[model samples]
Target chain A: MKISHAICLSAALATAPGLAFAQDFEAALKARQGQFRIMALNLGVLGGMAKGEVAYDAALAELAAENLETISELHQAPLWPEGSDNMAIDGTRALPSIWDDRADFLAKWDAFGKAAEQLEEVADEGQSALGPAVGAVGKACGACHDAHRQPSS
Target chain B: MTGGQRLSSDDLSAAAGDGDAAAAEQVFWAAGCASCHAAPEAEGDALLTLAGGQRFPSDFGTFVAPNISTDQQVGIGGWSFEDFATALRNGVSPQGRHYYPAFPYPSYAHMTDADIADLWAFMRTLPADQTPSAGHELSFPFSIRRSVAVWKWMNLDDEFVLGAADTESLARGRYLVEALSHCAECHTPRNAFGGLVKGRWMGGAPNPSGKGSIPNITPGALDWSATDIAYYLGTGFTPDYDSAGGHMARVVQNLARLPDGDRQAIAAYLKALPPVAPLDGGG
Candidate 1:
């Protein structure tokens, strides 16, 4: 019983509470996390494929590529999870500058998301493309994390 | 120098005093200053910024390189020679404030007394600093002076020294790359408390500037020829002909000016390091 892209997209549409045009950030952040998780998985699976390093290579690659496409779609659709707990953890590799500079982080994230989409273009070519594709993804991760995410000191 | 043998303090002072410039020179050579702060070619375009570069990036943020030249106003012109030595030996400023370990004072503290003096002697002769030093913008707990002193007292040593070297070339290389150049502090990623994760030596992290990842240079040699690595350090162009960009551009410029042998030796040592596990592996 393979769930098709139509069904997955439909699931996203139907699950939303309403206000299709509404920027209900809480829902958007939830949605975006889902997307990044999928994208991360996409890179992982493709990396695995490049090395021929795992079982179920074809299946994993297919699922990963598919997720990569969806993740790219949802990029920038979520940020700053609304109504989220503010229990801030200390000793964060995160610098105080980020909170002070939200606009810059968002702008960089937007650019990062766009570059991430290019990964799908390379990835769609097939597993042989993964090693370089991952490099592209690594660049995006670095660019954003440099501006936003704290290094795990 | 490893195997727990350090020159006696008196031997080092005596070497400098007795005008045995060779022993004094050996100490200076071992400390790794010529690795970066080179004497200007008499071409009249003296390279005034004898310090490593205009800026260095770390887990915290980017720090600008200070002018090491003996120039009085712009550089440490007002200081006694001993003041300069204390900065290197104890990671303190000429003003007696904490010198951040970002200067690699953690490893440099291992330098012996005589070696430090010679290095200072060498620094005094540098093209004097025209580059004004940038003050750091550290956060609250970090900005405090006493805490830095405590960090120095505990985590840093004041002795001019290094961890014992084993193989001679390897020892020489380590002295240059690690202690003197403070390569590991940047090239290696840090743990949560901002300490170098030793096992991952030279495994680069995203520079604190939030610009780009300095590619892991431990396994970095495999991606290029030894000459290519040396050449890039010397000239900024990889063998691929692609120029290294961003913050590394400055580092390459500094490296390019170094003595040829120093560049080659550093490359050889970096190439020989064990490849650490990559952190970005997909699940």
Candidate 2:
């Protein structure tokens, strides 16, 4: 009876780690991927307006605005889940320093979230605000990257 | 993780002793410049060949690296020997414009004059196909290089050479680390104007390379020994399972080809230099 119980305990312990592993890094990657997709699609909507390639559709514009807000809200959270090792999810490249300096890394994310939120508010206002919205969004991209991104070759 | 991570600083005891131009070229090639610059076709995450196009995504936005090949119409082909030396020594271009230190001129500046000559000769020998190197797409104050000069004047001294009190080996290391290599430009943090924030030397910078952070590499890396540091420079791996990824692989490749004596000198120089907190942008 003792042996059977020990085996059961050991087996249970072995499976425990597997359960935690179920939290796929892919989920994080796909979320960022989704951000890029939606951001690009929204840009397409804006570009269409600029080029007069498509007639201004209020409904389409509304969708783009919604996407902008969603992305902005998402940006407020950490690009990488706390304790993550993946670089791509963070919308950055590979450099061991990201993991090496935790405080600075987190601070960069915090700054980015603030800028993203501001841009989202502007972007959600509609086509009339595209100029400022683009600038705000661009600024957010720059703010996160300047301090945290790796060097150019 | 620590055991295999760093390469032995002394392992390259067999490095070719001849520091001639040929040897210099050999080091340059071994350093993996071709991996990003010389490829006939651009690939991977890199944006350009030697005509640099690698985009460094930073808090400021994505800054693309410039092509530095000897493309006469488009690259450094027009550069004279002095032009090259000035760029390396001062982190300025032939046109006297301040380079963003993205060229690794800080570390590259530490290379021996002879090695610089060799590199120049080799670069001059590359295909001179002009691919227009564009201006940095920076915002406000950063878009201008003159302002960069003001920043340069504040952050860097006239020239931070090795002190006479340092040993010959230490001097060599300083020369390589500061001038030829300019490792500090990135490995060292900056003040608001982009100068090497005083009191904070090479505790590792926020890796301006558009990738991962470059970590605080003082004795701060508790697991690393002096020998371990040397080995990692020689090999791409560190003592802890971390290998030299990103642009640092090129650094290891360069060190691997350098004379064993020179590599040790570099390590000693690093050890002796005063330590400082690079990015003290307190959270």
Candidate 3:
């Protein structure tokens, strides 16, 4: 019985790393997608105001901008583990170049962070100020997306 | 003015004089010269450098954009007005070689002589980079330069796809799309021979990179309002707030420089297109 128990323990130990890796892949993909979803939600609020699709409320705009800024500041490295690219997994729009060209990728993230900070500063200023700020943030988003993300399906 | 004919100095004499640099700037943006010629990820004034080393990979091969900057040694600076016009209108280089269709001279073939002259003048004013052009890495017969003449013979035509633009805006939009912008080059599906499938006009294709598919922008596929489309062109934001990704971001950068009315005209033209079904699960 002890030998059987030892055998079972060894088997579980052998599979543990592979199982953990699968979980990590799924978790990382979900985390990154969740972050993008949150960013999109907040951007939608600002975009609506900029386009006059919705009435501009200083409070709402400020809140959305702050949310974007806060989210952009998160330690996103954990959500972009090396093998979590679309080539390695399904349901991800993240391209392999994100890993292959990591320095440029990180630089784009920094740009988006700067743009978000700028948006947070000027979002409540007025509709005119908000429009350009929102545009800057959008461009920053695109600057990264253009080179990194897969096209929308 | 044929597909493989080189323009003579006499043929270009009418346009040899100074072109309107101001108007030419508009043509530059419309032609999206910087989209391929500019170094990857170049922005701001760096976009004006036009150093040209972007790589476009397709089934045929990888085509590297040539340096069109004013560097006399490696770029087109030494080429005459006739050389420039012939390359644009006839898909032939000054060296008496046929240029591959990947340059999109097929669409440029429809460009008016004045626009070509204006574009040339604007390009002359830009900064020069001395980067030597990398040749295309094509497969088999495609590697042969002479083979391009056959491809050009089969595919080169200047006919506009849209029959008539009832409105002035539509006419302008048609010119921008069918001639200057070469939107169909990416959005339209291509055949086995790499010729555009005109029947699938604006029907998105599998990306030449073989990653994601290009979206079909025809009226059937794109549900965005004209305002939304124009806004997306200007700001790179979709109606749902998702930003333009991939090569479209570069296109947005170019289109955004145009007047709002131009973006709206493009949107109007897109809306006017017959809804082509997405190319069989491609988009």
Candidate 4:
């Protein structure tokens, strides 16, 4: 995961300047990827319930849905600061489009948040509603990926 | 070897009067044209506007879909039914130029004359857009439209790639998946030059969209029962409870819009396909 350790060491020896910014960018990229992974895991739990792969436990669905809403609505603007794209940071699929089209990217993020909100609202609806609600959230995630996220390598 | 027949404009124009708009609408949905031709983020009635300029980045280059709306000058409005059939069946434009396979005519070549006529009539009912087309952005050799003729010679068989359909569901599934749905365009691996590799049909390949590989649907790879497969098409949920994400989510959206019979037929056909190990890193 440490893609630029050699470059970072060379830069540190060349100049004291820009090292902290580079480190911060690396941390931000890792943090967002980690955030997305956690969201996927949490969503998988709700998805299992929705698909009837796992027993429909209302309590567990609520917990998973709430966790998804929390992660989606969290204020993590710093995690997407410019220069954290795949071009700047290897091992990342965050395309330059995210920074280039900031408004669209943020709007897509908000779309996910709205979908998560809907899921949270309906998590208590048991079997029938949970399936469709989870689907809505999945659609929102895909919409964001389609417009903003680069395809995974 | 049901390569499409060329419908005379007279025949199609007459049939146009008797075309079943309801059935034509089903063909439109099954063909998934809006998946590429419609503007990004288009919804509801906007899906009917065929002002195609969507850019699909590919290994060859970016292929910009042309406007197929009924605008006489920019779209296909002035095209005779024969002209349209020629493009769909033979990958030749009305001007007799070779069309790049990006239009998926290789699969569409199997369409019956009636289906094509129905589609033409249905498209005519949509709003015409005069929007100019943004053509393909390819480099040197690929940019040469004449070269597509050679590529077609090597790749375009225009036959049903699958085995004989023994059952009614299999027959219906064959039409829906092979002729109309064109599942092979992505799910099947292609050779170095981007022609579908028949030997590895539905064995999956590197995602043309550049995501992780598309999943293999061959029996060896996907062991889901027909019922599970149908359910996934309808609801977007995998057997393991994970929801489909990425481009598949859009495919599911379209599949969900289809009738239950269509979904079931797709599943039955998929399950009936010959088993093969994935060619690429397909799951």
lDDT of 4 by residue, A1-153 (tens): 355776675676477544334465767878887888788788778876765667888888889999999998788688888677766655677778888988888887898899889999999887778877877776676666656665542
lDDT of 1 at A62: 56
B133-242: candidate 3 lDDT, tens digit per residue? 99899999789999887888788876889877899899889989999999999999899899999888998888898877888899878999988898898889998888
Task: Write down the TM-score of every candidate.
Answer: 0.51, 0.54, 0.89, 0.80
lDDT, model 3, position B159 = 84
Cα lDDT tens digits, model 4, B25-75, are: 878878888787887667557988989988888888899989998999999
lDDT of 2 at B1: 10
What does the lDDT read for residue B229 in candidate 4? 86
Give the winner by DockQ: 1 or 4.
4
Local error of candidate 2 at B8, Å? 42
Q: After best superposition, candidate 1 residue A148: deviation in angstroms? A: 24
Q: Model 1 — interface RMS deviation?
A: 11.1
- DockQ of predictions, in order shown: 0.02, 0.02, 0.61, 0.24
Q: Name the regions of candidate 2 deviating beyond 4 angstroms.
A: A1-153, B1-19, B26-49, B91-96, B104-115, B161-165, B209-212, B275-283
Candidate 3 versus the native: TM-score?
Answer: 0.89
Candidate 2, residues A7-54, lDDT tens digits: the string is 664676597643222134557656655675666577556444432346
Question: Model 1 — TM-score against the truth?
Answer: 0.51
Which regions of candidate 3 deviate over 4 angstroms?
A: A1-20, B8-22
Which candidate tops lDDT?
3
Q: Rate the local accuracy (lDDT) of all candidates.
A: 0.54, 0.54, 0.86, 0.78
What does candidate 4 score on TM?
Answer: 0.80
